[model samples]
Target: MEHIPHGSPDDPNPLRRLSLEQLRRRTSIKWRAYPEDVLPLWVAEMDVPLAGPVARAVTDAVALGDTGYPAGTGYAEALASFASERWGWDTLAVERTRLVSDVMTGVVEVLKLITSPGDAVVVNCPVYQPFYLFVEHMGRRIVEAPLDERARIDPGGLEDAFRRAVRGGHRAVYLLCSPHNPTGTVHTTGELAAVAALAARHGVRVVADEIHAPVVSRSARFVPYLSVAGAESGFSLMSASKAWNLAGLKAALVTAGPAAAGDLARMPPEVGHGPSHLGVIAHTAAYRDGGDWLDALLGGLDENRSLLAALLAEHLPGVRHLPGEGTYLAWLDFRALGLGDDPAAVLLERGRVALHPGPPCGTGGAGHARLNLATSPGILTEAVRRMAAAL
Candidate 1:
């Protein structure tokens, strides 16, 4: 695929083109979930406009009336190229990759392929809420390895969970949230290496959800779980949905490491039938030609990250906001406010600001809420003020 450069690093912000009114006009879940008077920050959708390349690709496909079932390896090849350029993961085998309807579907399907019903899946708690729900729905037991004091992937805690997950002759699976969700702590190469070793020793298969890897901050570099040593037994779920704001398109890639190729080969043929054809085109364009736009979006999000901290400090000093190294999500600890566990409900009803409740995210989430930071500074400031006033 040919890639066209959209802008340079010196380019002005491309994400700020849309105004708040323009954003509210969106019919997506993020905008439609709450009343116009309420500020909706509960969902993961970003309030940014589409990258020029992605919009053009989707438009061209529509113009051509080329909306057949998805075909070809364009999405996988584009992702492999992006991984090589961005993360120094040059050994990725595009042929070993598969397509899925989305990240969560890929995770659930891969879990099904590797483990039987009633097997255990280990996840870091206070993690992505869907991890617990999907695993349980798949008839698998949930084993949690809670994050350490600093909200990092705890190596010791992981090994302990792995031991428990594999007990009683159960097939064990580890659902790794790389550059993790909510907390935004990007795992180091050493941490991933330790996880790989532990999973190997405990006979656990590692499936990494790397959808947020592309939006990392300048202060941190994202390391692909499959790129680390001893990670050959793992699988990765990746998509352009989160970073490119293409969630409505519905497409994702499920890549298998060299050692796990045979396991993925067992995936049902119909499993690849759900991805949208336009989604493939848009995702391909984002990976191939949207580099400059991504860089600009990163610049905007980095500013918002700092802006959120300043707003929180001024309006709600008691709230502990840890600026994460990646993702546009902020995990706020509201314990200091003496709010009961899951303060999001209080904020939503009283402050008229919707945030994702924490307790549903499992351990380490009491008295916390996950705030979406991918919005205008004015909106963020207003949300903080409303939250403060709710007190």
Candidate 2:
């Protein structure tokens, strides 16, 4: 395969041109989690170089010693602009946006403002693992609404869960993962609208985690949950962390819909204190000036997605995978190979390729693993080959 041209959006390739040797030298969790012999595909981190604009913004801030407490709404304004241009969400209110340390942190703060301890929080199963972890850590109980046979959200299942969540007149929260993690099922606008209607009728508040919205494939459109009708009561958590590979910066935004503004205002002022000043600068640059680089990345990811399907078919035919319309993570079913419920453990111990275990994602995760697809074609193919060899 041809190498992606680094830093050029017009090149039509999105994979970072960096080689494995270069990536392995980094101290990120993705590379350092396992021994040198293991191929790490477990974490969400992408093997990509920073966008030119983002790097420049951070470097400029460092050079001037501008690092300090974050101030102003520049980050929010950039997000508003990006939303309007990218998703046609022109009514997104920049003034109503609040900054937080990260997407998950923002989610926890939002949940705390709306519900009390022991309140039920609903989630679709096989979701981003942190959703389950954080909700429980916040002194709330988790309610699973597992996806349907097609691995997409089932309206009936969601409504049932919502009803159960609100039983005994308890306030409930629904944590939605748009462009859902693990499965990579990008929820359609119609689906989101229906969800909004259901949540309204059931008196449930929806908190959408839309951090992966920017990285969706061209085949699908990312519908902002708050943009749907009847969603004025919802909250949205967004960031440049996932799309721009800036997780270490620790900055994210929490935005409230028209009806939920008061709820957001109720959040403690200290909730905003943890965001890094440099994170605001870098994320602002990403939303305002990193379009070309992001476009290039999308192109590269498009190719990688296809390449992964082909490689899996050839090397590990027994592992069933659905070609996702968004995100770089691929959900693979290893049940056909009888790898047991925790295929990831087998892959790590025998195949020497680390992957996220399926069981931890709750129901619908048995005998499965989530593979990160944001790496070079060679590495992905090799990982598949190793899995095949292990079996």
Candidate closest to the true structure, highest lDDT: 2
Candidate 1 residue 173 Cα shift, in angstroms, is: 0.5
Per-model TM-score on C-alpha atoms: 0.96, 0.97
RMSD of 1: 4.9
Q: Write the per-residue lDDT of candidate 1 for residues 1-391, one digit (tens) a residue.
A: 1121232324456545656667779999998988988889999999777888999999998999999999999899999899999999998899899999999999989988899999999999889999999989989999999999788988989999999998999999999998899899999999999999999988999999999999999889999999999999899999999999999998999999999999999999899999999998999999999999999889988988998888888889999977899988999999999889989999989899999999999998999999998876667777888899899
Alpha carbon lDDT of residue 78, candidate 2?
A: 97
Clashing pairs in 1: none
What tens-digit string does per-residue lDDT give for candidate 2 at 98-149?
9999999999999889999999999999899999899999899899999997
Give lDDT per model, in order: 0.90, 0.91
lDDT of 1: 0.90
Residue 88 C-alpha lDDT in model 2:
98
In model 1, the runs with Cα more than 4 Å from the true position are 1-11
